[model samples]
Target: MGNPKQKWTNEEEEALRAGVAKHGAGKWKLIQKDPEFNQYLHSRSNIDLKDKWRNMAAAVQGSREKLRPPRPRPVQDVPAVPSVPLQTPTVVPAPVIHESPADHVKDESGKDLPDAKNGPRYTELIFDALKDQNAMDISSILAYIEKMSDIPVPPNFRKPLGARLRRLVQQEKLEKVESSLYRLKTNTVETNASNQKDTWPRPHPPALYTKVGESLEEAAKTAAYKVVEAENKSSVAAEAIKELEKFSKMAEETDSILQLAKDIFDRCTTHGEILLVA
Candidate 1:
């Protein structure tokens, strides 16, 4: 015997039509899975039935509109209020004050000072001094400049130096280490070289003691000792000359030979014979 066919009642059809109208079609599976709408179906064989029902409902709605009465249009009694005139505010021009050519000349204290020919600004001189020192801190650099040159730097010059330092920091020529302390920004080559690892050839373990034919380690030690001895000798000769400079008892010929020997020793011992020819 064949199984009984599922039947959809009028109430169930109306409910489904309303559901499709409310939620649109193609989601009947979701509706069927819903606990509320499950009771409306007989066997769940009508899973594709929502699409069919929606199409039928649309056709019925279209056909029924021909028999239904049309709605009446609304009547209007009140008119819109007339717009009032708007006034735009007038704009007033601002007064300008002009100053004479003499007004801008003044010293740091804001007092009227004599107009000196502005050849080089204070900031330029400070920057030049800083550059000469390779971007040293202000105090040490000022001391060095004082010792080296007769340039007089006033106390108020710090203001211009500060301004120039700020400008150099902005331009990336110098970088501040801390407040008021700065150093020159190292070039790319310098930075890269510093970052690079030392890959130069170093003496191997065997070379340190005994290699191929000769003892390289002993030879290296001897060479290093000789270089140190030569350096010490040069230092002694320099001290002797300084001692002679203080004394009045040394003979002229003796002083001349000592100076000559000192010069020869300086060239030969200090630079390890390479500078002697030069």
Candidate 2:
């Protein structure tokens, strides 16, 4: 006869869920081999794990169906009767509200399950978790978010949580300090420590100050040399100006001599004309 079928314990189910969350579904062998979950699921085979997960999923779906409210019946159109005038005015009624599918989905414990697809809320939750602590590993972050959340976090939440953290790190909104540890990008690692003081723009040593003073002295010497060079250039410019003035005087004298020679030539021509007439 076949061995008696063993019922799945809560610990085994939890371990299986954790394994599925970490390694992903369909990797039954890997999940079973995982050390973290092996203790709980050592006796369970891969086939058992797969069947158990399927059953769990089916049970959840069935419970959700049971919790779902029945659809409202459509009202058929009726012929209006002739109304008699009344002394009092008629009162209007409020519309009937129907529950959505999300509202009906609850865990076995009757707690509302958290939506893994809620990206913005998840982002806020991660930020809130890291804001209080200096740094936290992925597990701690997940635990903190779960503790603070009003709804029960799903077992597959770890997969989504890892993805969200990677996205945040990529976006530069969060910093990954180590392999699994994460913190806010803007937050310093030593923020929690009170004894540590900021030491930015550290003071220069006496030797550095002495070097700076020497540099200043060299700069002053350079400036003085430049001033001397400027004075020498000024002197050369003055000499050039004096030479120009001398050249100008020589040009004027040359012009006067040319004019005098022209006047002498004109007088000689006039005297020769006078002699030829005589």
Candidate that would win on lDDT: 2
Determine the C-alpha RMSD for candidate 2 after optimal superposition of all C-alphas.
47.1
Error of 2 at 226 (Å): 82
The TM-score of candidate 2 is 0.28
- Off-target runs (Cα >4 Å) in candidate 2 are 1-119, 187-278
Question: For model 1, which pairs clash?
Answer: none
Residue lDDT tens for model 1, 56-116: 5444343333455562423121111100012112221111133222222133432211111
Task: Give the range of the ten consecutive residues with the poorest summed lDDT in model 2.
Answer: 204-213
Task: Report each candidate's C-alpha RMSD, comma-separated, in the order given.
Answer: 44.8, 47.1
lDDT per residue (tens digit) for residues 217-258 in model 2: 232332343333333333344666653453343333332222
Going through the candidates in the order shown, the clash numbers are: 0, 0
Q: How accurate is candidate 1 locally (lDDT)?
A: 0.37
